[model samples]
Target: MDQHSDAYFISRVVLFNDQKAFEQLVKRYQKDVRSLLLRLTAGDHHKTDDLAQETFIRAYTYLRSFKAKARFSTWLLRIAYNIFLDSVKKEKRRKNTKLYPHQKSINPESGMDAQLDYTELMKILRPPERAAIHLAYISGMSHGDISKIMACPVGTVKSHISRGKNRIRTYLKLEL
Candidate 1:
């Protein structure tokens, strides 16, 4: 039921083995999860989809362990973030490549007038900075919520957003 609370759905899952309740949770947050992943993956839809699938799988496996200290969505995002970090670590071991495995080079012929879009702008940020900026600005989450998700202090989240924004501003100015 659309009107059902997350707690109700979660309770059903924990007590009655309700798969549908879990599906409801997944459906409610999949777009949000996928969008965040798409940003992190630099718009690699295939990789984003795979990671998103892994995220839900892990979430379902670990649903019983959820303590409800934070919002369910926040918990799910934390799982996604951890999975992304794990994948990044694995990729580094596999190829010893840069962050974006299939990073595209700027076409010299595209000329000086090319302006960086959001994805291009995000590419300039380090992972922690990118995650902080996205959670704060795009997800409309509080600094405290982001700190919980990132498993860091609120001050650190604020610092990440501040530094990330400064980097983006500098990059945009240079691009122009």
Candidate 2:
């Protein structure tokens, strides 16, 4: 069976208080959720782990509310995305507050052997663009699926993907 059906089955079990079924669902999706969280947090281990846990916990708590109108993975990812964005906002606020001492000096020697990796540079895109590309390309999600996850129109998702791809091409100087 497809993953959605599997999730539906698990949800039914969990709704009836079946812990084994809940554990099975966790085992199935936890790795994927953690990987998505890791990418969203830019490899921040602590934040990613916390967000992943939160995603699952929230999913479990709301198990009875799932309507099966959307794929389970899509709903779970929406949770992860929201959590990631909240973390980003919190981090931005912390940075603005400057709770830590600021350093004024840049070490010239630090970059002496560090050449710019163009592929890595692509990751510097804004979060929306990065998420659009990652979901459409890496995760193989349809534009419609992304639209639901992002709470935007499908056309907007297409636009984001198009603009994001064009920008990446320009940044990498690659022919599209």
Candidate 3:
């Protein structure tokens, strides 16, 4: 589709609350959103799904407010990013409250596999750094795209990626 047609298509779904049009939008963007969420949540499939769902729900709810100053993907990703941060905050509060007594503790030395270690490393990074690295490395977003999604400058995005990568490398004991 041409750029204007695509914008009009998405705008119809937003302005008119067209379910089929929204579904088309979902089919077009769901994979990218889920993949971005998966990386941000450190490959936690369940949390990724939950966050992606929340992201889309939020986007649809706020669709009428969309200014169209940015691409739909960029706008959707900004929503997803907020959802991720909210989820993380909620999880932290839940942990602090000990709401679930039956949760299993993760042991670093249990030979769990590299995936677990990577997950643990992600947990250690600050949210912005983690988001930046995940967008750049895992989702393959350009620095400029990440900047738009993050509402930060491109140079800040690059700095986050560099610092996040360095921290992860140190955590994993990898030479850079």
Candidate 4:
């Protein structure tokens, strides 16, 4: 049934190579994966979609290797993170460019509302830090889950979240 559990679908896919079950799994988690990628790409819809598709492809190809030690969503996010990193490396190579220093340049004519959008805050955080905040807060993922997802130690994930939160707080001038 459609209400079957993730493990149920996973078993179906793993035991029988049931494409329909795998498709069901994809349908269930596609939005979560896409939204994460969208944030990572800074609202670049095309890049988010491409990376999400690649994540799914990698998941499908490597389904048999899934250990089930962590939640499937966490594993999926790990794949997505790796794919995004790979994409970033490829892009940098293609452009033969280095990361420029973050410059504080506000457009004089931009509306105040544009300035207030959280995406503006997100721009200040680097990829790993942003992913940490998004995963810990937006995705409701635990630090341990994020550690697995980002392939980092738990302490590193905590540091990223703390540093990211501090930066956002400073940007918004919030005392929490």
* Structural similarity to truth (TM-score) of each candidate: 0.87, 0.75, 0.77, 0.87
lDDT of 1 by residue, 1-176 (tens): 95799999989988998999989988999998998888778777999999999999999888899999889999999999889888988998899887655334444443236665767656667777878888888899999999988899999999988877777656554441
lDDT of 2 by residue, 1-176 (tens): 23545666666676677766766777887877787776555555787799999888888888888788898888888888877777676776878743212211223333324565533444444556666777888889999899888889999888877876766555545577
lDDT of each: 0.82, 0.69, 0.75, 0.82
* CA deviation > 4 Å runs, candidate 4: 99-114
Worst 10-residue lDDT window, candidate 3? 99-108
Alpha-carbon deviation at 91 in model 4, angstroms: 0.8
Return the number of clashes found in candidate 4.
Answer: 0
lDDT of 4 by residue, 1-176 (tens): 67899899988988998999999989999998998888788767898999999999899889889999989999999999999988887877888765422223344444433458766656767778878988888889888889999999999999988887777666666664
Position 112, candidate 4: lDDT: 39
Instruction: Judge candidate 2 at residue 84 and give its lDDT.
Output: 74
Model 3 regions lying over 4 Å from their true place: 1-5, 97-121
TM-score of 1: 0.87
Q: Rank the candidates by lDDT, best first.
A: 1, 4, 3, 2
Give the higher-TM-score candidate: 2 or 4: 4
Ranking of candidates on TM-score, top first = 1, 4, 3, 2
